[model samples]
Every structure is written in structure tokens, then in C-alpha cells.
Target: MTQKNTEDPSSQKNDSDCGCGGETGCRIEAVLSVDERGQMVLPKDVREKAGIRTGDKLALISWEKNGSICCLALMKADNLSCMVKDILGPLLNEQDRS
Candidate 1:
């Protein structure tokens, strides 16, 4: 399944790609099933389009709402560091002044 983003954040896919585009600007890209071993394979076309290659690592992230896990997102392993910095950079800088 392919989805188009009728909004910003093109290709960056920075954990917030949302990929769901339509009247609501959000939709499911694919439905994956986990095996008994708890492993799911991403389709080849999606992987190729995302530049994900063999041996590439991914991070599974989840969002909590009302104290329950409500959403999930997958991110390239390498991008996690940059995301951490982007989130913590300001807080770290602020701490330096203390």
C-alpha cells in the first residue's frame, strides 16, 4: 500500500512522517503481521523506496495516550541519535547555564 503526503515533511520521515494522506492527511501505509517469533518483514518495495537495505536496523517507537500505548512508528536506527539531539539539545544547553 502506498500513501501520499499532502503536507510537509517530505521524505525526511523523521519519526513524524505520518504517511497518512487523504481528506484527513493520514492513512495506513501497510499492514504487517508478526510471526510467532515476533518478527515482521517490511515489503521489498517499501524498503527500497525508504532506502532501507539488508542489515539495516530500525527502532520501534510507541506513543502513549491516556496512559496506554495508542500509536506506533518505526524509524531508521541511525536517525535516532539525531532525533535525540534535536529533542535534548535545548534542554542540555539550558542546563549549562545552571
Candidate 2:
């Protein structure tokens, strides 16, 4: 599935001329199955590269856009808030006015 954004950090290509010239920008497609207990196994390489651990905190986010549902995991607290604000800034301001 493809997603578009005006200017997205994750969407930036890993081209040789781009900021992330390494394979970090490469997207590895895989099928992840959620377990009966609502658990999914993140690939080992991905886990290591992301520095995710057994007890580390992760923010699970799901959203619908362009007629498709998308899910993502955020590892950092500040990043999670920034992402939420980016997606919900208008709504957040409206709520503040009440």
C-alpha cells in the first residue's frame, strides 16, 4: 500500500542523493500476523536496528486515510505526541476552545 504526504520523513526515498543514503530508508515488505492475544512479532533485524527491547515502551497508532487503514508503532514519547499533534492539530485546537 502506498501513502502520500506533502512532505513526509518516512516517505523520503533512500536515493543516493537523499539524506538517508543508506538502506535505512528502504522499505521491507512482510506479512505480520497478530497472535490470539493481540501480539505481533517484529522482525529481529528491525527490532535490533530500532533498539526495541522486551520491556521498552511502544505507542500503537492506527488511522484511516484515503480509504485504507494503516497502523504504526512509535518508540519515543516525544515523537508520539508530535505525530498525534501533526494528525490532530485542528481538532486539538477546537477542543481547547471549549
| Model 1 misplacement above 4 A | 1-25
Number of the top-ranking candidate, with TM-score as the measure: 1
| lDDT of the candidates, in the order given | 0.78, 0.66
Superposed Cα deviation of residue 5, candidate 1 (Å): 31
Query: Which tens-of-lDDT digit does each residue in 1-98 have in candidate 1?
Result: 89887676544555543334355554676899999999998898889877899998899888665576767878898899888999999999999999
Give the alpha carbon lDDT tens digit for every residue of 1-98 in model 2: 78776796855654333232245564644568999999878889877888777777777655554556544534555577888889899898989999
For residue 53, model 1's alpha carbon misses the true position, in angstroms, by: 1.4
